[model samples]
Target: MLPPSVVKDRVGRTLDRMTSQNIDALILFSREDIRYLAAFDQACICLVIPKEGNPTALGLWLDIDEARRQSWVQDTRGFVPQYHLRIGGGEAQRRRLVEVLIEKGLSRGRIGIERGLLTLEMFDTLKSGLPEAVFVDATPVLKGLRIVKSKEEVELIRRASEIADCAMEAVSQITDVGRKESDLAAEAEYVIRRSGGEVLSKTLVGSGKRTLCAHPFPTEKTLEREDLVYIDIHPSYKGYHSDLCRTFLLGRDATKEKAHETLVAAQRATFEATAPGIDPEQIYKAGISSIESSIYGRNFLELYGHGTGLNVEEPPMITKGCREKIDENMTISFFQGALTMPGSYGLRIEDTGVVTKKGVKLFTRYPTDLLR
Candidate 1:
């Protein structure tokens, strides 16, 4: 279903914050955020900005049907009434937005935008087009609101996790010797979406040293007795996604078995360390406790985990140097990396966890043990 209430509350909160931040308007570009506001089903370029009377969205003629739906939008209209087709001329979109901003009195006020997603070319275009506008960094403000999940959002994510768990279960049952990594990945995807999962990303089923490479795509790598097979799935259900990683023993890998035991311990430590108000560094330490300190000292290139919500990645990072406190209702991913020599296997066991007032709750329920 459409997230009308979430958008409504979000819009209300955003307008309140805009008043305090002195932001007159925000022009959004990403589809996810646009979907959140417009509640549209189709994907097309659209613009949304706050104004004196109501928020406005502008789209090409192709998205007229979707824009008219107004799932979360209070008001919307097509860019040109006469034009019955989509146009992508850089100059045309720029001029229309400038005119809208000027009419809304936002030409000289603070205009919010996403700096990372918006290109430098587009930034220059907006700047050159609207010389009087004072652009403000709205990323932080919007991120703050999105980091915490509402009850409804959490429910949707839980539903996604359930579907992912079913996919993993099916994959485990059908997987055996003589099967290729790609075959297993296909089975997982097939079972997952058929059982109501929306496949948001491609699956990863790497074997042996291939597992050492994070996000290794499905390949024809044959199974080996002493090979460590790792499968990771990032799935979306009801528009909420779950990113999970699990390991498997192709035949009888002694190194993989030992690594699995160590990783299980490390994951347990990480889970135990996670709770509302706890420092995220403490969680990272737990993830690395089972391994040697030198490994983390020299090879810690990525974050321990990150918050997950509407998108695969969310704000309020769970990593070192980040002080974003874990609050109740915040949903986050708990991931542990596997980087070492010898067998060259990376063991990452991740789950969607929610922060509660007293403790943390994991949405994923699959067993962590790898077959020997």
Candidate 2:
């Protein structure tokens, strides 16, 4: 959990943005956004942040007490019947939210909402309840505010990276010929969970032909000699996410080793080229140029990296034509590699890091060597 001062600063910054947009109030529904501002870990129905007063978090009756205990928000409420015992939990919560908005004098005022995340039911309720209010999308505003990491956020991400590194090391030790791809995934997951971390996304273990497939999950297929296997681990500590991937060659093969070397070179080039004020597109170009010089250049993947923190993939995605500036304090998951052949084999390497005045400070410190 972040300090109360950090949460206050975040809410203050959000309120500033809201005032600039002339929004009378802001409604947050997504768990990510809600947790960002409130530190409420459980699923919630609504979190209303007015322009002048404290924010209100509305959740299910069962989780309301936990919400109060966990979040910095003081005005947490649970579902209660408006008049009789007829309304359901969802409707009751929406009704209470509308009342709160009305009480705060925002019933017919300009409101900001996460249009991309809100469900159709919540949208309809808000529109009908506050017929004269204008709903502006707050997706960009919210995303923009979280692009740069605070010192606390960076530390959580760093710890998560260490967890990923441990998982990768465990996977490397057990990866051998005849082992099931699922076994590697199991070991990685066990290490992460035992380390007080969570696997919130796919535990990818792609081997042989499966390496060509994007975001492939582990299966029961057994590993064989001279096959390429890639393990992508996603782990989170205290709501912060980190991604790390390493490719392994089951048996020594010169062609596969060279392919892995090209990936490492590309990753290194991308890292060396990264700095504050750099264009994300330039980073992509540098990585692609490194790959183009290799034998497997034709099979290069388009993406070079992405911003990572609360989520696995975030803004300022490093790709061709991306215009977002690479700023200091931004956490990035620098990744590059490509398929050696269409249906034969592929290799990839990834690590998490933070952008500093000097360059990207890598968080995941596991070696990128192709484990045998």
The candidate that wins on TM-score is: 2
Residue clash pairs of candidate 1: none
What lDDT tens digits, residue by residue, belong to model 1 across residues 1-372?
Answer: 356566668777877877777777887776666655556645445555674556666666667666676555645556564432123336666567666677777768788887666666667767887887888787755668777788888888888888778888877876677778888899889988798887777888887788767678988877777666788887887667887778877676665566567666766777788888877787777676655543333433343788776677776677777777778888877774665453566666677778888677888888987884
* Clash pairs, model 2 backbone: none
* Model 1 spans > 4 angstroms off: 1-5, 79-89, 293-303
Q: What range of 10 consecutive residues in model 1 has the weakest lDDT sum? A: 80-89
Q: Write the residue-wise lDDT of candidate 2 on 97-211 in tens digits.
A: 7788988888688898887776777778878999988999986468678899999899999999999999999999989999999999999999999999988887999888999
lDDT of model 2 at position 38: 84
TM-score of each: 0.88, 0.93
Candidate 2 residues lying further than 4 Å off, grouped into runs, are 80-93
